[model samples]
Target: MAEKFTDEEFAFLRYARFGSLPERVKLEELVALNETEPAPDYSDLAYDAKERAEG
Candidate 1:
């Protein structure tokens, strides 16, 4: 059986995991950064999946 965390313990766990992350970003800057990234290529992933299924 899994042990359950109390609210305080859960809050501590959440902070422990993400406390060091940057907590703020301008929406416009984030959008501009996102626009500069190219779309992901999944052709090789599809081919790998097809091979696994056929094998």
Candidate 2:
């Protein structure tokens, strides 16, 4: 099983995990990228062949 998170929450969680790095990513740039990028399309996610067929 898995838990789902909103776009904003996921972004924050990622930052919390990888915010510190020697590679140097600007927070503002990351924020802008997130704002411009579309969220994932999960409308077709299924558990098995039967669930997929139901769609």
Candidate 3:
């Protein structure tokens, strides 16, 4: 089965695939302006994947 994705996962995937740092910062700015919840922790996701592979 395909992996499930949280909102942060989708954002991180989009950022990694198509966004520069400036773009990400801009997205954050936009989210803040709109009073949206913060995106998920992509680094945590990455760490979890690495841990799964190593173990």
Which has the higher TM-score value, candidate number 1 or candidate number 3?
1
Give per-residue CA lDDT, model 3, range 1-55, as digits (tens).
9999999999999989987556234554554345788777999889999999999
- Residue 15, candidate 2: C-alpha displacement in angstroms: 0.6
RMSD of 1: 10.0
Residue 29, model 1: Cα distance from true site in angstroms: 15
What TM-score number comes out for model 2? 0.33
Global lDDT of each model?
A: 0.81, 0.71, 0.81
lDDT of 2 by residue, 1-55 (tens): 8999999998899889988447777776675333566655565343455586887
In model 2, state the lDDT of residue 44. Answer: 34
Candidate 1 stretches greater than 4 Å from native: 20-55
The stretch of ten residues in a row with the least summed lDDT in candidate 3 is 23-32
Lowest summed lDDT across 10 adjacent residues in model 2 is found at 39-48
- State the lDDT of candidate 1 residue by residue for 1-55, as single tens digits: 9999999998899889888557588876675333466755799788889999999
Superposition error at 21 for model 1 (Å): 8.2
| Candidate 3, superposed: residue stretches over 4 Å from native | 20-55
